[model samples]
Target: MKNPVPLPAYLALCLLLLSGCAAAAGSPGSAGPPSSASSSVASPPGGAHAAHHGTETGSPAPAPAGPSEAARMVCGDQPMDRLTAILELKEKPHTVSNWADSTFTCTYHLAEGTLRISVQQAPDEASARKYFDAMQALAKDAKPIEGLANLGFPAYETADGSAVFQKDSFVLHVDASALPAVAGPNAITRNALAYQLSTTILACWVEHH
Candidate 1:
């Protein structure tokens, strides 16, 4: 089978989160190990006919692709769906790309602009903070986001329209190219939305554990 196309960095992040959601939910397809982007898209169906010697003799079977079992446990087959519902978006959500079990990302088409949500695993709280710190330079009107580090996760928002935060063993990042009505004015809306999404995701992660 051909290798699956790698998703853009922003989209890839959403995919990673979706995959983690799948694993957390105990979905069988994504259970054993991290699945690559190719495996995610090219998965064979459950009832694929087998050739002698257990070889896939005919065309590859089509696997029912969606979020990993882990993702479903918290946010159903698509984590973005939960986000869209929260954002009260009118456009449909679609997966941009993903990596082997590590991350999942999706884009929500809106009149304002594309909104991307990425979720990834972090080794520790410190590691996630370090990563966030490094990206701080990009903040145009950088301001510390409140109520996150107090919970053991440090967070920040940039004037340029981005929000980042870490929680437990996961990091959440959000980028908005254009302002959505739901996000409100200035960074307030964007940061608030980021806070909401990160907290919700953290809650789900906690529930799974």
Candidate 2:
């Protein structure tokens, strides 16, 4: 070799070469420096989030059920029709019904008077018979209605023109004290009308049960 290079000049040349290599590595033509990957994510469409979380979006709950068949029979349209036919009601009577203490009561308000029907449901047949016997014993001159024997067990007419009878665990009473008088002088009596109403109700019970 010719002349030896100075120490300072040699060190400067090495630093310049290192800087050029770094710039070339960062350029568009070369691979980029190390970095973290993208961290973003996309969501699903249309209530998919709710479905994923076990929820039904935009839906309503179901409705509750109505009254029982027995309650409807004791206080509904069939008996009303029978009352109209037997009493010859010119106008539709105003009606009200209630249920309490295992009993159902229905009252019809007419222009001339009121008609009432009551049904008591006991726990067992023995309890119903006991109650029926007690009612018969308490009636003011209770008389067994031979004609209504087919209607209920030991049917009877009360002193106040009502009919009381028992069948199975059911005790029924039809009070016709204020029924309107029919056109004929020999029209059916109130007691007979009570019996007729009881017969209609018993037929309904038999049909349903």
Candidate 3:
């Protein structure tokens, strides 16, 4: 079943920006416009092609694996330890919810308000991309986030301090009710914090991949 996104009020301002990402993803004619050029290789110039006639092509890279049981124990079922480290929160998350499916959710008490993080496992990359596209359709007024492009996937942070992205077969979300007045000693802003948290979770996906 397709999950309908119910974005919070703060995210309304991001709808316009993300709509394009979704549009681009769903466009049949668009395949690799924004994908990094480094990911592809150019064909060799030759008067006649002989390498393809009888040469053996190498095996493709292995398919990414699902999240590990250790990951489920560390973050999926109980994410407080991980969240606390990233947010520098004084108090651990007060709420935890592990759904009937593999969706793991946690809510933390912050100085300004609440911060919620949710992680859900999709069956495969296509399913994960479908959700990422869905979330992009719900964003507006977004700007390209710097320094996060090397995570082996497209990642973004919204103007409203929310971040959403997918890696492997996982969809990760970080939403803050309000940005902290002053980031803890480490000086991580709400948006950067979201990106950081997502990266950490994506590492888990990579480990199993």
Candidate 4:
């Protein structure tokens, strides 16, 4: 059976369609300025690329340059025990015996360029933790190192060359002379770089210990 449609409803729908056609015909083009108009409606605000323009009238906005290399990295894991052993380079082949041998990396971005640092080891956590502790002590007694005091990648876990944290702070600062295969803008940049690397180390320590 065919259902009868309400007259008002049908008429209103027809009027809306007719109105839209009339409006388009009478109105000037709504297209924006020619410079750029964000073509893709679905793209993110700062998307790297613009969307399809096949059916569109707008162009995509420019993508932001965004953060540099240094800005991309964040602080990560290395903790007390891991810090000590790695810094000290204790037990060479053996390491702290608390973690496994692996590769670690740190990167820094400066107006000059990006500094990438990589540290490779073949030892257990306990040994690496020991080395890390010794290095922390040296960094403490070592001169202010000029601009690096701001970083505050302090010495942790004292005795047994173990790094201790006054608070739960998990950071480490080092110089190129301090750790091989790590590159940074300057000592400060390196310190920041070290801090990032330390986080990774700390993660390894946590897994093993």
Candidate 5:
């Protein structure tokens, strides 16, 4: 009979074989350098998948389209609800009060100047006319505003029915001069100037009366 190895020696030999097999593969004591494949295997699921992702395969998320190329976007969101604009005046409380109803924008256009006044009225030519009337009164007495420099002003009414209150949209235009040292630069101001005039005139009236 062939000589048989001792039991302990056989067990040791099995352990050595297992250890060597581990080294060949990428187990704990493996000798070969780590490969990309082995690293992926070592990595956890989510991280590896995210790292090696390709471009979106199918049905990718859509992008938002930008603003439309139009001259102006009107009424994308305008309120249907109605509101009034008010100019708080002092001395001419009754005249100012006349404007206080259903306040809205009233525009006055003149060859030399213009007036934009906020007042109350229903939506129509008639209300707009009344609003203009109130603005005219305010303009005749509008004195020197605090900040505006070198200002010479007079409130004149336009025979042309350009300035009026409307049921819906109201626009008031006024020609406010800078009172140039040379009378050179004349400009038509916007809403704020008109507002300022209205405020100043009314406030002064309030202070006086």
Candidate 6:
């Protein structure tokens, strides 16, 4: 070192060293604490993050209930179709159903008239027989139905074209009196219609049982 450096040159060299040190500190590869935004993570949409944590955000919907057993017996497709065919209806009848106090009733509104079917379920066979016998006794000019005895025990038709019968703990009544009278030679009467309807319902009961 023969000659000393000038004061301005020495100052400029010191400033260049200071700027290099500052650039190194701010470099992308430098080891430093992460910023607040860089350290935080965002969750996915539609509760997916909650699902990932094995948590239940909500419960699935429950399934709908089905029709009751008694309602199915009279209002089912088979019996309804049979009634439509027997009445010679151009279109399906409008139907109304009611269930109360162990009794199920279905009413069919046909083009010409109304047809009603009622089923009363007793606690036991004996109770059903007693109720049916009382009803039979109260009927005016009730006659025992010959062919349908096998379908329902002591089946009968009332003077008003209502068919009544009992099987086990069930008593069924079919009332077709509101229908118009059949006029043609081969036309079916209301009494016969009631009997046919009763047969169909009893067949359904046997199949299900």
Clashes of each: 24, 0, 6, 43, 18, 0
Task: State the TM-score for model 3.
Answer: 0.54
Which prediction has more favorable lDDT, 3 or 6? 6
* Candidate 3 global CA lDDT score: 0.46
Which regions of candidate 4 deviate over 4 angstroms? 1-109, 112-122, 137-209
Candidate 6 per-residue C-alpha lDDT over 65-183 given as tens digits, one digit per residue, 9 for 90 to 100: 32236334666566677677755667787777764444556777776777888765554455556667766776777887654243336688876678887877667888888876551
Model 3 misplaced regions, further than 4 Å: 1-79, 86-91, 98-102, 144-150
Per-residue alpha-carbon lDDT of candidate 2 for residues 22-113, written as tens digits (9 for 90 to 100): 11111111112111222111112221121122224434222112213443454555667656765576666777765444455677776657
Candidate 1: count the clashes. Answer: 24
Poorest 10 consecutive residues of model 2 by lDDT? Answer: 22-31
Q: Which candidate is the best by TM-score?
A: 6
Q: What lDDT does candidate 5 reach at residue 174?
A: 27
Task: Give Cα-based local distance difference scores for all models.
Answer: 0.45, 0.53, 0.46, 0.27, 0.24, 0.55
Highest lDDT: give the candidate number.
6
Estimate, for each residue in 1-209, the C-alpha lDDT of model 1 and write its tens digit.
Answer: 01122224324444355445533443323433323232221111221111111223434323324344433332234345556655665665543444433334444455566665554433334444444555554456767765423244577666555666666434466666365534522223554455445545554555455
Q: Residue 182 of model 2: what lDDT?
A: 35
Q: Give the candidate order by descending TM-score.
A: 6, 2, 3, 1, 4, 5
TM-score of each: 0.52, 0.61, 0.54, 0.23, 0.19, 0.62
Per-residue accuracy of model 3 over 1-209 as CA lDDT, tens digit each:
01022223213313322221111111111112121111111112321121123223333222224323422432342245546765566776555433323344445556667676654445445655655665565577555444424345756567667777676655677765376733666666677566555555555444434
User: What is candidate 4's lDDT per residue for 30-147, written digit by digit as tens?
Assistant: 1111111211111112221211122233553222132111111211222222233334423222111111012223333223343333332212223234434444445433422223
- lDDT per residue, candidate 5, 1-209, as tens digits? 01122334433433343322211111111122111111011112232122223324533222112111110010011000000112221222111101111222223233233333332222333333444444554443333222221112222322321121122112132223321111112222232333333323222222222
The worst-scoring run of ten residues by lDDT in candidate 3 lies at 22-31
Residue pair clashes in candidate 6: none
lDDT of 6: 0.55
Q: Residue 24 of model 1: what lDDT?
A: 49
